[model samples]
Target: MTKNFNIWFKNFHAGIVLKVDVLIPTKDPSKIRPRLLQVLKGSDWVGEIIIETSKPLSRARVIGARKCSTEWIAMFDDDVEIPENWFDSILPFIQLKDILAISTPSIDVNNVHMIAYKRVMDHFRPLEQRDAPFIDNTLIKREVLLNYNPSPLFYSEDELLYRYIKKHGKWIHPPSCGVKHFLVMKDLVKAAIIMEQLGFYPLYKFLRSRVAYFTISILAIGYSHTYKTMTFFWKSNIKLMAGFLKARVNKKGII
Candidate 1:
């Protein structure tokens, strides 16, 4: 698979002059990190693969933008498994002048909680047309990305970049561009907590309403495969809401 990817990469990038770098910002070591590195190294289209484990995701991205020697950078999470032909799928758009950045939905159906979560997220920001781009599987131009400072929280950081990109230039979500994101219940809860802490309004604006949110939550619980998983999903949502409410009461400003 790796050899095929290299051959494909060389064939495609041979005509294109732009160099693409990859930056992975992770707070702690992850189980999937090794596989992720292996996959990235396999691609000849990718120039430098910089993994920064020291800073928060937002700061790490800034570091990557500064450190990268290429014109474009693909920012991704450590947990994401790049799909085969991922570069080939998006290379056409990269060749376009107006399309400054590109993003796609992360597909993962292994966990029931993940299914429910993705459903809600898809509802809000459909892959067909996104108001802002997601960072997990996105290709961004270094010039546009170097302008601002993103929030420390992962979700909010993505939100900040989305808005910034919208203000700067064109961003797109091509149907062909997609990646598999391995999500766990623990990480989901942690992300939700961070969203609330950083003033969840960034993502909240994309949501339909509180009513829709809870309705989908109930439907997700109903569709769970096992009682244990259902219980975990329920409790996690509760804790997430609690954190949001607490942040609201404390008068945290939403960026």
Candidate 2:
């Protein structure tokens, strides 16, 4: 468990009056958690350090945003490997006059499943010129997030929320402010189960399309020549398909 504390600091930007609060949404403490803490706590501009353990990313981010009393809220995932000067890199994008939220590119560090999964997902939901869909590493204004109050589903809630915010304001993706994402499969499996219980999948929006995902899975497996990569893709697809179908059979709406 996290011993929560609030720290105050003067706004760090030269011309901009931006006060930032970093929200870390984590369910369990892994090796990544301590590394993440080190990165986030090192920043002088980050004011509030809110650690929400054992909560969905969607719910955690929403709760964290509401608690934030700063100009910006950074809903960072706990498993990310953040670079030094992360704040400095993101500050300019967040400080943009019209940007409601800003997304940073997440580079896959070592997860083969993530690398393959990302390739498949890109076909279903491609990145927009002005916006990046994922909120795993994102910066948003307090009012914008609170006003939208995103209702996320089983998966790709970040994408849904990004589209929702895009309607009212701008979302930007800058390459300079990228973070390394480690996709742990156990966590993904748990999250998928939770999403099924919440009744958010089976709809034909975002990552709700079973056919699209399945098709990509087949393609991913067929394209890979190595045994290890093929096995990883196969197992991943089987698990996802099983969860998706189970949810669809249980519910009567939007399968």
Candidate 3:
């Protein structure tokens, strides 16, 4: 349970500005660093920029987060394009005593798998607060992450943190603070493989999320007449399920 506090969005004093440390966990910092710099240039709340190039992204995030000096840390993926006003837009959430973290939405996203996955997720959590952590562009407490430090897994580390915070308090999804994801079907597929390999993610949630997700995709294929779109959806799901099954088989030592 969180303690009650007065809303401070209106009382945002210009002189007493609170800055946030920005952490970008990516293997390709050479390419993404300048891009991130350009995107975050306009923000007043941005503090130190920590770019970690560790092999496993989760490990990189943990390293960068620990280096943060502010009360909050803004963790972003290498690929997404963040809105300039994002930090200020989510200030209301930052002021909330009950809030643990805030994940910004991926707007104007074109990827077939992401669109399909998010559409299905909408039914489950309509406020854009997903069942799994969407940490692509998120504002999180520095200490909270250090306390429940994410593992060095290639994937599903965000899920681990999500489950931990969901029990303790709220993780907000503010629609106004939007980002653009430049991810593909291949990424999710690889993530699924790594997720199974890691082996600690909740099996029930995985089964339920994937089952309902691809079921909707299959249903869409049967009913929809949009040839190009449905075909793309079909191909993406094939690779996705293939990765999952391959991971499953590998995990069971059946290969």
Candidate 4:
């Protein structure tokens, strides 16, 4: 959470008109509170920090939304870092009348192929099928959230919200505004597993439609095994490779 606060402050300070609310929902408040306090010590933009225990991600978001005092709220994951002038580029879009939500671009720091894969996959998804990019990194109006209740059962709540907004209001993604995503190779494998477990099997199949991700995952695993000789790293790489392989076997069209 402190990590997110630092990144948000560094990349998103404007001419004092903008106010920010940083909401953190974690299962262990005791472990995170001290660190959060240290991070929030001198911040001016932050309005509130909401902490919850043992709640699912979607429910945590709803809890955070209820605590927000401002008209606009920006959701973000704890690990992401917004590049400089990120807010400057997207400020106009946020200020637009009738816009319910705005999503900026996200770039991967490691495994550049992952970023390419998302663009290719997202581009191909039907507008109705596509969700707002990353929920944590997107900006939303309080009114939109007030009107809609997020379902904890959905695998991708961000997409669910985006689809709802598209149905009832306006949703936009600007070309210039984006975040730099730092994804360790291990995190990528864990993400694949979580997605599959959460019912994002369709995305897994779509990304694995060609030999590109498959070959990359395999070669990445092989290289890690042969050169590093670290069992943990090797295993993580293998896990990602297995995910791609599983996708090949499933081969179902996108849901």
Candidate 5:
């Protein structure tokens, strides 16, 4: 399967000069996987495999993507698992016109915060377009990406890029291209992220931003998952809100 797929894609992209640079932005180097690096480096379609580290992951990603000279870039978080035929999966969409970026929804965990987020996103997920770009594993054109610079935000940073693509060109998401995603969506991690994105907002805006996740659907997720899980789930929510309020007072996150 691997050998034939390689031959097929080499033929498929025979005349194409465009290639992808794998950009990985991480704070903790230990999370970086050798397997992912190996696969990307071994692939013919990949040019530079750059790893960059900086504060507030968004900034780290921007730096790595900016430094690459390739016309296309594939950005991945430290936790993502790259499939063997990853490039093959994204080949068809690359042939389309006016595609500024391409991404797939993350294969999410069934935890409380993650499940709730998935439910909320599903309500607004577009028929043809995905609601948000999963930056963890995405293929995008570098020229189009350089136009919109993401702020040094820990969360909702992708929102800036997503809005631009939605307005300007196609942000195609091929279902076959989904990657394994590992994110800490509960407890302190979740709280820190919310604080970074929402701490400066007025009371009403902060409340409004979080209300959707506080639904009965979210509560039921805990119940169905188990009573013990529900207790921890609410605890995480409490920690998140409390941390947000504290950050609101301090004007920063985890400092």
Candidate 6:
């Protein structure tokens, strides 16, 4: 499958250059460098894989996308797994719509709580209501991005991009399009910190609401016997409370 993907990628659309950019920022670049190289060596789709060591991931992705010489660019996180059919699903949206950007759904690895949270949130509100219309990392047109620089602000980049694309061109979301996000607990903590830094208080509120909803759903639904509902509730509550307090404190200081 990898070999076939490599062949298809190399000969992808003759007379037109389809360059895919994978931007990965890491504090310990040496650890992940070899893995990235191995993946690139196997696939021909990668045009210019930018490794911005010790930089913020959000900043690196925007910077890398800006520097791309391709008509289209796909930005991905390091901990994501890209399926061979990802482009196949994404291509139709690009060809059909006057699309400046498109986003896929992301599924976290074995994290049922995260999935539940996302599902419940989506049920109540559309992707646009989630601060960023596009939740997953995106495939976008270089020209569109060049016209409007996405915010370099830590967590608001996605939200800013969504607004920019909406103002200028269409942003599409396809159901079949998706990416697997291999998220550990640490990633969640890092995300919270980034959100705080970006002053995304509303997002923090939404997340807390989702966590609370998840806890209630679990209790009401009576799902899972081995899982400790008490522990989950306690942990989520603590995090939510702390986030709320911090947001309030920040708001007071600003005022």
Model number with the top TM-score: 3
| Global lDDT of each candidate | 0.66, 0.64, 0.68, 0.56, 0.67, 0.59
Q: Provide C-alpha RMSD values for all models, in order.
A: 5.8, 7.2, 4.1, 8.9, 6.1, 6.4
Clashing residue pair totals per candidate (backbone < 3 A): 0, 1, 0, 3, 0, 0
User: How well is each residue in 80-192 modelled by candidate 4, as lDDT tens digits?
Assistant: 55554555555566545567777666666555445444545455563224444555466777667667776663245555666778778778777634565565443544444
In model 1, the Cα lDDT at residue 128 comes to 48
C-alpha lDDT of candidate 1 relative to the true structure: 0.66
How would you encode candidate 2's per-residue C-alpha lDDT over 175-226 as one tens digit per residue?
6355888765554443455456555454554254445555555566543434
**Candidate 6 accuracy as TM-score:** 0.68
Give lDDT tens digits, candidate 1, residues 3-101: 433544576567743457998878765654576677778886789877777576677888778878777788888788877677767766665556668
Lowest-lDDT window of 10 residues in candidate 2?
1-10
Q: Which whole-number lDDT from 0 to 100 does residue 223 have in model 3?
A: 35
> Judged by lDDT, which candidate is best?
3
C-alpha positional error of residue 97 in candidate 2 after TM-score superposition, expressed in Å: 5.4
**Which pairs of residues have clashing backbones in candidate 3?**
none
Mark the regions of model 4 whose C-alpha exceeds 4 Å error after superposition.
Answer: 1-16, 26-45, 51-54, 112-132, 176-178, 184-255
CA RMSD (A), model 1: 5.8
Q: How should the candidates be ordered by lDDT, best one leading?
A: 3, 5, 1, 2, 6, 4
Q: How many clashes in candidate 3? A: 0
As for lDDT, the candidate ahead, 4 or 5, is 5
- TM-score, per-candidate, Cα-based: 0.75, 0.68, 0.77, 0.57, 0.69, 0.68
Clashing pairs in 2: 27-54
**lDDT: worst 10-residue window of model 6:** 220-229
Judged by TM-score relative to the true structure, which candidate is superior, 4 or 6? Answer: 6
Considering lDDT, which of the candidate structures 2 and 4 is the better prediction for this target?
A: 2
